[model samples]
Target chain A: MRTERIGDRGDLHRLAAQGLLYRTGPFVIRLQTRLREVTDTFARIYLGTEVLEDPRLAHFSVRVTASSPLRRPWGAQSQFWIDDIPPFEPYPRTHAFPLLEWGINWCIGTRAHRYLLLHAGALERGGRALLLPAMPGSGKSTLSTALAFRGWRFLSDEFGVILPGAATVAPLPRAIPLKNRSIQVIRDFAPEAVMGPVFEKTRKGDVAHVRPPHDSLARQLENAAPGWIVFPCFRAGGTTAVRTLPRSEAFTRLAQNSFNYRLLGERGFLDLTALVRACACFSLDFSDLDQAVAVIEDLASSA
Target chain B: MSSHESAALTAWRQPTSVRRFTAEQWTDALWGAGQHRCLARLSYRIEDAGCANACPEPAWDLLTSARYYPNFLQVRVAREIRHLHRILRARGIDFVLLKGGAYLSAGFPFARGRGMNDLDLMVRRSALGEAEAALRAAGLVTATLNDYDQHYYRTWMHEIPPLHHPERGVEVDVHHRILPLTSRLNPAPEIMWADAVALPATPGVAILSPPDMLLHTATHLFYDGAILDGFRDLLDIDSLIATHAIAPDYWSRLLGRAASLELGRPLYYALYFARRILATPIPTATMEEAHARFAPGALVRPVMEHLVTRVLPPRPRAARAAPVSAWLLYLRSHWLRMPPGLLARHLGRKGLRRFASDSPAADWPPP
Candidate 1:
């Protein structure tokens, strides 16, 4: 089906007034945001993703709006609401775009328990995806974005969504948020990358997003089997080091890095164990994005 | 009063009512279920009614997501129970699982989609210290409530202030009895424990016997706590009755158990509301006997009936509860749980603390 791709400012505002049903791979989001920055950033970064004119289902209905004047004056604060429930206090209005991204992530992390969600960035090559599971500020997003430009299909920069009881990985393929130094770092590294306006002083420091590769966004529905699990860390001025992670340690670390590991219980154990067994696990520490991409490419060839 | 409400109530009572639901009515039913926090149960009901295929894709999707969390919690609850039993059994302490824990452990149909925030268990009053110690030794700490709050819980409440497991991230409520010690009605722990039934599959854990379960659910719903969005508990009563009321002597035994536990009034309200609202099947004779023997005074009964109609159903997000009715119900709940003097002291202290510690203007949207 040919779906609308939210393009014009007037259309964006009109849809925001009425809820916009936006599809992101397996999940559908009904989003409403009056904030121009949010809508504008979404239009730029979410290009090529289908916007269902009228979707049959939306997993989440979310809104990002200004806080009451009594609490904070207009344009000073914004609240992220899901089904009228605000999970967190309001963020500054300037941070509306990032707040919406984080809020949508929160909804998926909490509600989409049907999939075993790993807090990882994923990219596919040769029909198998390499999962980069790491903590925040470990440069997962930066590495994922770098690889997406290096001929790897970006599955997701935020989540490695594994279908239940399957080693196959589904692509969320949303925009890769570039945080703080990574914003300028990505700009310098991939000059061709479409970057959104940077929102200064977000909760995560200066934040902007890189538009997902058009090819990856076009093939968002594509799924890949597990090929390798690479736990990567970016260290300043450090020699590039790659070590084979033990299966047991990989299992434990993967569980820890999962969003719904405990919630999935034995199912999580089975899936993670299967994933660890099926994949070649490694821990890579690199100082250079080019070197990191080189190491990952070398690892992918063997897979 | 609205057809949306009527449709929801009708669908809840007889799942076949789903066949007649228009798009708006179906959405309303979903909203009602979500508002009452029973969407999971509704999913089960829809499937049972064979309306799963008939329902809109969005409703089923929402239901699937709703059921997902509860299923997730169910597995965790089982693991937590197993761990707790391993610890408590070493001390020779046998505990009765309460509420959601009991429902899940006992494998009730209603347990399928029930979301649980914590695991509640009642040990013998004499063993309270030992159980608390056991939990503490296992690395669960009591919440760092203020001195006044701690004092109040220890002094008057049936359960200690909630305990938190730092690693597991689950709350555990340890109760030594059912009702407040100083309340006008004290349902003895012995009576409940005496009739409690052991979960066959989950050995070493027990739940209140069928009749005592209903009474305790009733007492908790109508007497023990703030009834904020408690329509779910009321559904528990209806489901329990629907499942167990088929036994030849269920109603008689329920009434007898309620009397023995000094929970006749709660049981009466439970039966009244369950039948009046959800159309739960109760023997006419039992309802009449409960009405005659345990009904409130004429003036009080009329007022309660009015307020209950307002408060029992799920309210729309935009609609406020009838403020006066809600406040009166709140006072009644407190009065039933605590004596007059203690109630005043407790409410006054808590009110003042709330006023003083009010979040810096930003906490405008209270959960």
Candidate 2:
């Protein structure tokens, strides 16, 4: 049996070996081993103690404890139990991956106290950022991965942290975790995409992370004005198509998809409305990655 | 005795004001004795007040320990819910309170510990005009809105701008449907009306049934990535599950109810999260049964897991996994509530608008 543990003392070294660490201010995350499973962008994750479990968090801090070495159904084997503990406290004696994704989201969302932390995934090109806001399985990661592979700079695969008083998306170049078939799809589509080892059968099916493109990493400090807001849908057999949406509908959707819109309240509403007002909004449906890529390329070239 | 002294003695002689009679100088003694009972009565009034004292000491202790601004907002909102309920009921516009306020009034002990903001109420959509009128009559007015904004609400949106009571100063959002107007799933108001459970505190005021209540809670959280105060919402789910004795057929009934109303996906998300976090009494086989009716995508499971684990508050080892599990129940409820077609429409409509260029109407996507 393989054990999975979060916040285990030895997990740090293991994560470091996996090249998941990326320093942004005082935070760092253990990038999931399989980066290619999610996106083509270079992504890093910070593993931390689950200090507080509030529903508003992006991820939960969890500790899993296994009685002995256990093998995950997805194929990664572990020998640890995971136990979640309060944030800032010492790691408990559990032997599981002490995840810090949601905990970090809460920290940034609340503690950052300056910028509004959004839930949409963001990518940039030519100093222009496009936010891909959708519910899970909307092919957001797949689209973001495809775009990054095609030379678009990866701002973030998970969050679009809009800086205060600016319309630009501050780059938080983190690993995008792709799941199940998305892993194989991205691998076949972007052959040169550098991906970490796959962690199987833990949760969310077999999961992998994709490294952000080097260009995106290089421009991590840069901020890009939001130029486009597209909601991508991956229909199994649908033909590729892009349709424009109305501002009112877009405003509602963005607000709904937004992580901090309500927190931003009037400001969130104003900023999001202005963003949609200024940007070209669209709905893209594609069964083929190449077709979707082509459409985005065309859209970018035209913009 | 002189008139002034006589009046003072008379005032002091009242039994309610004479509890602390052994004070200093006569004037000081009178004031202290008179004020002590008033202060005590005020304290007693606050203690006996609706839902204000509903929170447990530990939760209050935890909240005060944190100097975070949002924490203050959380407690203030909880207190406001108690106050808002009293005022709304006094006006005779019966309300089926949703989420935090409902849970607190449902005899759930943990309601006090749960974090919440913005009181949610469900009123008949037909009565929207009357409801708005009543709210205004009771001093709760809509937030400021420009002409275009008012048109948008009246024309496009499902509900009006959140209402704020002048006296209570708490924002209250009166909702008809869980999702926006464009969403495909529209659970019939009659079903909500049928399953409407009366509040224990106020007989005239009723709430959505347990399943419906869970469904609504999930829809609210999953449809929009609840960013601002999601932690509080998660806690509400935890408390609801911990207190309610949800039946085995609850999932099926919820799914059936959602299907009847066309709210599939929203219910699925709700049930999925409720089960994952709170580990609410939902049987796995039942969950599978429910999922068969409203099959979620492969991506949803992992995302659900990620979300449940992510949002659940950190607790000690002895703390039950009920909160995480309860979230899954709501996820199931959300899935059943909003089917794929509706999810697609919502996504499509939203995408077109956000990505549309200057030619708004010309570029509008077909629903």
Highest-DockQ candidate: 1
Model 1 DockQ, alpha carbons vs. true complex: 0.32
Question: Which window of 10 residues has the lowest lDDT sum in candidate 1 chain A?
Answer: A1-10
Q: Which stretches in model 1 have alpha-carbon errors above 4 Å?
A: A8-10, A68-71, B6-11, B14-31, B48-62, B67-95, B123-141, B145-147, B160-172, B188-190, B198-206, B316-324, B355-367
Q: Write the per-residue lDDT of candidate 1 for residues B101-218, one digit (tens) a residue.
A: 9988888887888888899899998999999999899988886787987887899899999987787777888999988888888888898888999877656689988999899889
Question: TM-score (0 to 1) for chain A, all models?
Answer: 0.95, 0.71
lDDT of 2 at B89: 62
Q: lDDT of candidate 1?
A: 0.83
lDDT of 1 at B45: 87
lDDT per residue for candidate 2 within B59-97, as digits (tens), equals 222222222334344456666666656665666666677
lDDT of 2 at A181: 95
Q: TM-scores across all candidates?
A: 0.89, 0.41
